[model samples]
Target chain A: MSYFVSPIAYIVLLVFTVLSGVFFFIYLEGFAQVQFDTRAQLFQQSFSLTEFVLQPYFGTISVLLLLIIPMLTMRLLSEEKKQHTSELLFTSPITVINIVLGKYLAALALFILMLLFSSIFVIVLYLKGNPDPGVILSGFMGLFLIGASFLAVGLFASSLSQNQIVSAVISFGLLLLFWIIGASSDAETSVVGYLSIINHLDNFIKGVVEVKDLVYYISFIFIGLFLTHIVLDSQRWR
Target chain B: MIKVQNLTKKYGNIVAIDNISFQVNKGEILGFLGPNGAGKTTTMRMITGYMPASEGRVEVSGFDIADDPIAAKNEIGYLPENPPLYDDMKVTDFLDFVAGIKGVQEGRAAKIEDSMNKCGISDVKGRLIGNLSKGYRQRIGIAQAILNDPSVLVLDEPTIGLDPKQIIEIRELIKQLGSERTIILSTHILPEVMMTCSKVVIINKGRIVLETTLGELNEKLDGDNEIHLKLEKYSSDIKAKLSALQSVQNVNDLGSGEFIIKSRQRNNIGDEIARVVIDNNWGLKEIRPKLNTLEDVFLNVISSELKQ
Candidate 1:
């Protein structure tokens, strides 16, 4: 909550909105070129606004979150330790659930805020033309879940160290590992494929919501928080 | 009230604090005195429930820390050596957040204002904590600790690194707070213990060497007394003559006709030392009792500990 009043919060918000706007326009331009091109005229009817613009726009922002969410969460727990404020929290009447959940929810709120700011592009699409509401809704739900999962991983990384830069690096590294883990999915690698964070979100982006993806993200968040709880509990005894 | 029983902390294969035990009554301030790295921080950490002890347990206001930490921790407020503060927060907002975590559900605004007023930080509640000076920052730390009105306050070197005026003001604040609450303050400073604590516990190398009321500790604290003498002219054998006297115990030559004479049991042997100097035909220019230092008090404790 204190971070909202500091310059770091505004700086991240500005960089994210500006960068997302540029990416939105770039994707719009690419979509425009496909509509007018001579050779692409035949396939134009096959790809609706959902396929070319909204899906990819959501995809680009999802990738953008890969960079921005870590920045937002880098200080979540790491700054608490670096400044020794964890002592104040630990010594107070607050439980570990209060600490972990408060920080995670705070980061999630900031993430939801960034998503709301970028939703202007979707609203613009809604005002200008007819797009599938189902696709848009599912796409947003995917963004929320994927964004939350990313934050969970980032929060775990933040708990692992007292250095913000190290926390960010570890967070980005872990996200990338999960992002590409699905690419190696094969007959023998089915278990690894099931663990791909982006694969679960792929269903939501395409206007399809599955129980497995919902279960996957909800369980991922729990596992991340559970690991954080273990680390914090042992940190005291250590 | 607070109680610690056979508390021990071990890190890996080395013992940090071994079988320590003490308690604080409802309104007494117990000064934890020790040298640097004497496990003062470790002990305070365990007492505050920030760290768990390897063996034994701590009970704060009748709740076992290991069994019911949240309830037990509710009774304690701690100020660590570094003052565990968030620099970017405004003073008032930080206090409000602290209140939320401490579960101060009723009359929070009044409590916040009262704590701020008590610590003398109400004037700077609008300023960023990071922009405050060391004194104001330290005061903010105290204000937050007292915000919830906890029963036990564990302060680890609350007056460390401050000017004399700030130190005196902090001591006064601590003494004032001690009237209604039980406080366990740790410091390596001798005068700090003397001024603010009702009882004193001297720890060294992870063990408590002595624990007594202020009256007895003051006797030991004021036990070391020596006399200094400066001569107008260089003198030989003056130190030997002074050391040989029945009243004087030892003498240190501070080169250029200056000597420091140690007396036994806080004796005022200025006349005996002057008689020795005059009879030895040594020029006597200046003479007075030596100034006491914190080191002298510590040496007194160590020597007394060795005696037993």
Candidate 2:
């Protein structure tokens, strides 16, 4: 169903190439200041693609994703309701869950397309410099988890209201809360600190595959999607 | 077949439909007659499972609406107050999408084609629904409702917002559709009820105030049998003359030498009056009987209700 629109595919490819080239130019310009004395140290502390590409990659993606997911999901149910076409679909033999998931998967497929395009950034760093693939792969894994979680939350917010503006505000508000909680909390008992999507994302950027952190990101995605399903189910009652 | 029992719906503090019970037999076209906001649409919505009733049991094709909505819904095709169309989509695509969701299988193309032809929407099938005229839009809406070939069809104001020509065409189309499908058509148009429906269910104040068959409706109005007589001769004696006849009930000599005679039973009262006029050799200027019609009954019922 989603294959007919190539804007999603085109945007991912264009952004990935443009952003990676801009970052590459910045790295190349910074390299001029390094002297021969740094060559040995550079070999020892090689610019890990995992650190150079994935950390900055996810940072850029997390913020960009917050804006884009809501844009894509805003029209999901709202347009259906506004056009009065929900009457046809709701009264049909299909279940509400199938309708929700069908659109959800379509959006996820687009997000995956964007992820595939971003993989070029890893390729650019690997060819130009000595970068480890393991860390880079884990970083991409983290990006996938964070993007999925954001999309789930955006989908839930989109399901809440028929006005796209309202859905956007709710999604932005939830994303902002997730962002600030870990940053503001004290370290010792900061489950909020761990809940910080940014903090969970940091472990993957550093090339360490922490199983517990992986579990946390996966659980976050699952919970957001589960809550979205619950919201849709409850809306029928109200 | 459909049965609605003890149906009641309330919006916040206001009651929309209260304790309404009615049943529709197989292969019947039942007209729901009510003035605006008299709960006709609300009851139709409840029966179609578009909204939940506060208290009721609705059964469609042997399945309870609340207990098995899927089964009940499967039996019915409903066109709501609005058409519920996706205006952006082309007519064909919209119908195809509905057919897909409705789970009407591989024969959907044939069904869509037949419905489009039947509804007179075949010419505009390729155009976007947003671009179609209001008449065509209504036809497309009806087309979608019957796309599944459901056993029961519910149409809420199918002829609303149309020109006279469109109204007649749509009415004729509905009459044709009603032949194969049991239909519940709700409208305030009295003539529409009289012409299209086999039975009338008149609702007032959220209750079924009257239920009348077409044969009974004619009997209530008693057909046209009143005779009017205009005389040149003064006739205070004519009142007793008419009352004594077996065919006449009572007679009133209207001022200006005209008299109106109402009969107790319908018969050839015009002939009886003409024979009496000939026997007396009176100069009768004119004689005519008033034709009883459905409008009289409607007016009588409303005026009586107002007086009460």
Candidate 3:
């Protein structure tokens, strides 16, 4: 709630929503042009709305979320440390894991709210064209998993510093590194390639709910949150 | 009750608080007195389980802070030197958040009200904490600390910045709270310790130099007692005659019938001074032993320790 109340959160949300909306309409117009050309030539085969519109839309959201998730999570622990409110939380009768999870969940809740806003585009697809419900559900699920993984990384970054800018930079650096790894692991099946979070989301984006991808995302979330807890715990000793 | 045994905190190669030990009995207000950077805040942080000690142990109500942090922390309430407040939050909302995190789910509303009333900040419950005055913020800090109704309260520099009236009000509130809960409040302010603390532990350079009750502190400070005397008539031989007394070590005459007679060690020099004045036909208007203040004792103890 505090995060939502901040103007920066609203600014980030508005920017991401507007950018995604513009990109989605541009893709829709291009797909409509191709469909018009096919109809003018009297072609029997129709355009797959899922291929041209839904997949591209999800892909764009994935990239946009990679940039925006850190903005939402950068202040989670860093701001508390800066304000000295970390003392109150540390002294309270709660474990470090509890603090980490509580903050992570709050950020995740905001991310979920942002995703709900993006769902308005999906509703347009449902009303205007024939979009596969199953594929749409899987793409949303994939977006959620990947976004949550980014938030976990951001959470860990937040625990490393009292400066929000430093945390945000670290988070961006880490997420960008993972995104690069995914892009670079085009032909390799090595362990490093497998560790790329973006690669794991590909299966879900293709509407295939593989156990390996699910496990990968779950482990990513787990590792991120676990590392955050360890950092917070080590702070007490320091 | 709280007990700290040989508590030591080190930052890399720098030792913040050396081997220090103290105890606060149930219902006793223990004043942690020190100069700036004297490790008062470090000690309080360790006791409250906000930070782990590099060495030694702290126990609150028989729960070891390291081994049983949750239970130990549950037994204590803490107010850090800065008050740990969220400036963006309203007073009521902030307290509610604290109550939720502290796990005071049962009767939380009543508890919040009670604490606010006790701290005398119920009127500003709806105002944003950042907009409140420093004194009001301090009270809110105190309200959060006492909201959980813990048996032990650890406050770090509870009255660092406030007006004289606010300081007195906070002192009175602390004294009232001290009737049931064991409290350890740290401050560099001398008179704050003198007025509010039942027992004071003066720390210098991360080590305890003196730990004694306020009553015994006064007695301990009587090592170099002085008697103040104001005479109506001046005599040339008054100073020499007063110094002639075995208990009188020295006489400092102020040239206007005002004199300060130094005693060797807690002697009854006031009676002797009175007798000397009567015998000399010099009218003695006022004569009394100059009591030693906590400030004198603090400076004397700290400087003596530094000298050693």
Best by TM-score: 3
- Chain A only: list TM-scores of all candidates: 0.95, 0.82, 0.94
Please give the DockQ score of every candidate, comma-separated: 0.75, 0.33, 0.66
Residue A219 deviation, candidate 2, in Å? 4.6
Give one digit per residue, the lDDT tens place, for model 1 in A75-127. 88998888889899999887888898998888888888888888888889888
Q: Assign candidate 3 its CAPRI class.
A: medium
Q: lDDT (CA) for every model shown?
A: 0.86, 0.77, 0.88
Query: What is the i-RMS of every prediction?
Result: 0.9, 3.0, 1.3
List fnat per candidate, in order. Answer: 0.91, 0.46, 0.83
lDDT, candidate 3, B1-308, per-residue tens: 99999999999999999999989999899999888889898899999998899999999999999999999999888999998888888899899999988899899999999999988899999998889998888888899999999999998888767778778888898999899999999987878887889999999889999999988986865656788899998878888988899888899999889999998876576777788789987888888877777788889889999899
Candidate 1 residue lDDT tens string, B1-308: 88888989899988899888888888799999887888999998988888989998888889998899989888888998888788998999999999999999899999999999988889999999999898888888888898998888999888877778878988998898889889999987887887899988888878888789887766654546888899977766666777888877888999999988888766799998888778876778999887655467677777787787
The lDDT-based order of candidates, best leading, equals: 3, 1, 2
Q: What CAPRI-style quality would you assign to candidate 2?
A: acceptable
Q: Which consecutive 10 residues in model 2 chain A have the weakest lDDT in total?
A: A1-10
**Regions more than 4 Å wrong, model 2:** A1-45, A116-132, A135-137, A187-189, A204-238, B221-308
* Candidate 3 lDDT tens digits, A87-171: 9999999999889989998888888888888888888888888988889999999999999999999999999999898999999
Q: What TM-score would you give candidate 3 relative to the actual structure?
A: 0.92
